[model samples]
Target: MAKAVLLILLSAYVITEMPQASWANRPEEAPKEKVTNLQFYFHDTLSGKNPTAVRVAQAPDSDKSPTLFGATFMVDDPLTETPDPNSRLLGRAQGLYGSSGKQEIGLIMAMSFCFVDGPYKDSTISLVGKNPAMNPVREMPIVGGTGLFRMARGYAIAQTHWLDPTTGDAIVGYNVTVFQ
Candidate 1:
């Protein structure tokens, strides 16, 4: 009885100390994810920035919260408009307001970044930003992606790099950092 009890304790100790070798054979562990960072320079034309007409109300006490807006834009290196398709392509942004009352501080913007040239041609990155005015340096979330940027998630810092009040032209600098 004493020898049997000692053997049982020894087996328990060995089991506790041994690493499960079966784990190694249960399919090689997935490759570690690569976190990558990428930047994009683009120019946006704010002349056509308008609220959606579908939700337009004419009543005196109607809810005036504009839910959607159209943002027309063109992407460029050094953010300049050029005829070269390699350096420039048409882009669009749809702003979805998330603020209540007449305050214009909080707004969520989902921008679809389309690359018409280079290695990521025809790829789109879905970006989301909530409450731009709440922080001094607003951060936008990278929700998803398509094509070469598959399963992308990161943050983008959008600042009004330059705004031309005369033509309503804005050079928005998007320092986009994405991980696929």
Candidate 2:
């Protein structure tokens, strides 16, 4: 199972397009190419007061902006060290997704992986994902970063590790490979 997951994550990264050169104007200082891999668990609670999941309407009328009537929310609370809920803190997944509505409206999202602990503590790895609402397996492009991950670029694969249908809570697995 682990091997299969790894293979899927790797392939996802290969399939996504690399960051466009126009996004950054600075020259490559250190190594032009470097790869870093990060595997962590994410817990998303959709039922909280400041819920991590929410539907956003572009206007008061739902029909006004169908494609823009999607949802935006956060994946901010989770255990990175272990799948267990009580594990040590790692960071947060600050994300937003949606179009107007439906499942196939050219879905996309910009998510920030903020690491509060570990070797990459206080750093952020930004990613842009397409087709975001299509279930458990999806690939996102690594655009840039801050702190230890400065000028980083790579891809991330997210898999549904577990979900609680009753509470709308979930545990997700993320495999991220970045070139700094």
Instruction: Point to the candidate with the largest lDDT.
Output: 2
lDDT of 2 by residue, 1-180 (tens): 999999999989977857655624656543367689998887777776866656543445434554445445444555487777688888887876555345354457677889988888889999786745436687879999999889999888888778876665778788899988
Instruction: Report lDDT (Cα) of residue 96, candidate 1.
Output: 34
Q: Residues 1-180, candidate 1, lDDT per residue (tens digit)?
A: 999999999999999999876745666774556676655555544344441212222334333434222322222222322423245554434333333324444555555776666666677778766745434466789888888778988888866656565654545556777788
What are the per-model C-alpha RMSD values against the true structure?
7.9, 18.2
Provide the overall lDDT of each model, using Cα atoms, as 2-decimal numbers.
0.56, 0.73
**How many angstroms is residue 15 displaced in model 2 relative to the true structure, after the best TM-score fit?**
47
Runs in model 1 lying further than 4 Å from the true structure: 1-28, 48-87, 90-101, 131-136, 165-168
